[model samples]
Structure formats: structure tokens, C-alpha cells
Target: MSNKRRRSIFEIFEEYFENLEKWTERFREALIEKPSWDHRACTMEPLSNIMVTPTEVIVTSDLPYAEENTIHVKPVSEDTIEILAKMKRKIRLDDFGITHYKGGFQTLRCQIRIPVSVDIDKMEVRFKRGIFEIRLPRKQERDI
Candidate 1:
């Protein structure tokens, strides 16, 4: 018979707790820092969601009016990533019923903090239909 091992109950619980902690941290960040336009210094905050798995972390954002060629994703640190995207057309404050701010914005900028360390070099980014998706592979621990 082939040798196969199943994870123990304790191991499963450990994994569940780790995931819970990670999601709790993310929820805290979201609540502490509102992603509204005013909180973002007049820049529009694109709605985003993050999903973490044992192998990778997936980040997705809704970037309306942004062009694929103008999108950029960079890993700022082991647990942070910066995203910038330029809109195809300028969005003026007047468009949002705010005439006092007499200027327009053409770019969107935001930073996302990952819950776990990731391999930036292996990260993959894709933009399609005004949506941006990023997949970052989790760093493997070396047993020494």
C-alpha cells in the first residue's frame, strides 16, 4: 500500500487559528483605515478583496476607467504591495458633486498589506475588463 499521512486534529486547529488571525488583522486594517475618497486624500479608493490559501494569496481590485497599459503593481516589502493605475479619462471633483475642489485626478494609488510573507519574484499580475488581479506565492519555510 502507498504511504499517506493525514493531518492531525491539532494541526488542523493550528492552521485554522492562523487563518483566523490573518483575517482578523485584515479586518482591523479595513475598519481602522477607511478607503473613502476623503481618507485617500481625494484619490478614489478602488474596492478590493484578498483571499489567502496555503500556497498563494490572491488580490483583486475593481479599477473602473483604468487602462491595462497604465496599471502597475510593485512589491514594497515582504508583506506589502503598491498598486497604481491611470484612468483613461480624468475624473474631476465636479463629477462627484464636489465643485470646490477645482481639479481632476487621472491616477489611482493604494497600498495593500499581505498577511503572510510572499515571493515577490513569483508574483503574477493580470488586468482584464477594468479589473486587476494579483497572485503572490507564499514563501516556503526551510527546515534546517
Candidate 2:
């Protein structure tokens, strides 16, 4: 008797969408359905883009289509400040669409450790152009 092998269904269909671009889209959608924690940022890094200068440190974040009063900032320690934001989810179909109530809560909380202690008394925070900037003064240095 002669030996014979049969190909599985997948082997036949593999040639149908042989292009890399066509297959890549399906692969990407499959990955999004089950998102992983790696999609999130590190805990220590600021929630958004930030810049620290010699005189002050600036932190910026953008939350468009968000109410002004939904943001909260708290000082956890002498050198750390935590920011928490709650944004309203939007619905394109209706004002109270089904999608709006589903996963309507969005939270971003991160503690920023300043290189120098911020003087809460003189601290300044500004929210403009969907950017939140916190200006903290540099600590005074004492000579030896």
C-alpha cells in the first residue's frame, strides 16, 4: 500500500489571503479584543508628557470633551503629587446611548515624584488647551 497524507482545512485556506497586509489587519483586531496590561503605562512615569526645568517642573495632560471640574489633584508626600481624573464618556448615536453607559468611567491616577519639594503655598496649576500644567518651584540650596 502507498503512503498518503491529507492537508487540513487551514492549509487550503492559507493561500486565500496570502498577502501580509490583509492578514495583519485581522491579527490586530484579534489582539485588541483581549487587551493586555502591557497597553498601560508605567506607574512611576507621569500620566502624560512632562518637562522638568531648572526652576520648575511642568506636567501636562489632555482630556478633551471633559468637564472642567472632574479633575482632582492631591499631595501624597512632601515631594509627590497624585492626579486623578474622571472623564465623561461620549456617545455618537444619542445623548444617553447604550455605549455611553457601558464602560463610561475613565480614570487616570499617577503620583509624580518631584526632584525638589514643591511649595504648596506658592504652587501654580493651569489647565489650558486640554493641557494641565503644574509649576513647582525648585527648593533652595544651602551652602556648606
Top candidate, metric TM-score: 1
Which 10 consecutive positions of candidate 1 have the poorest summed lDDT? Answer: 34-43
Predicted candidate 2 versus true structure: per-residue lDDT over 1-144, tens digit per residue: 767777788975776657666778888887744421121331112246667787777766665544568777778987777776654553222334644322323444556777665566667877788777777776665768
lDDT of 2: 0.59
lDDT of each: 0.83, 0.59
**Candidate 2 Cα errors over 4 Å, as ranges:** 1-46, 90-104
lDDT of 2 at 50: 61
Which prediction has the highest lDDT against the true structure? 1
Q: Which stretches of candidate 1 lie over 4 Å from their true place?
A: 1-35, 38-42, 100-102, 142-144
**Position 27, candidate 1: lDDT:** 97
Instruction: Give all TM-scores, in the order shown.
Output: 0.69, 0.51
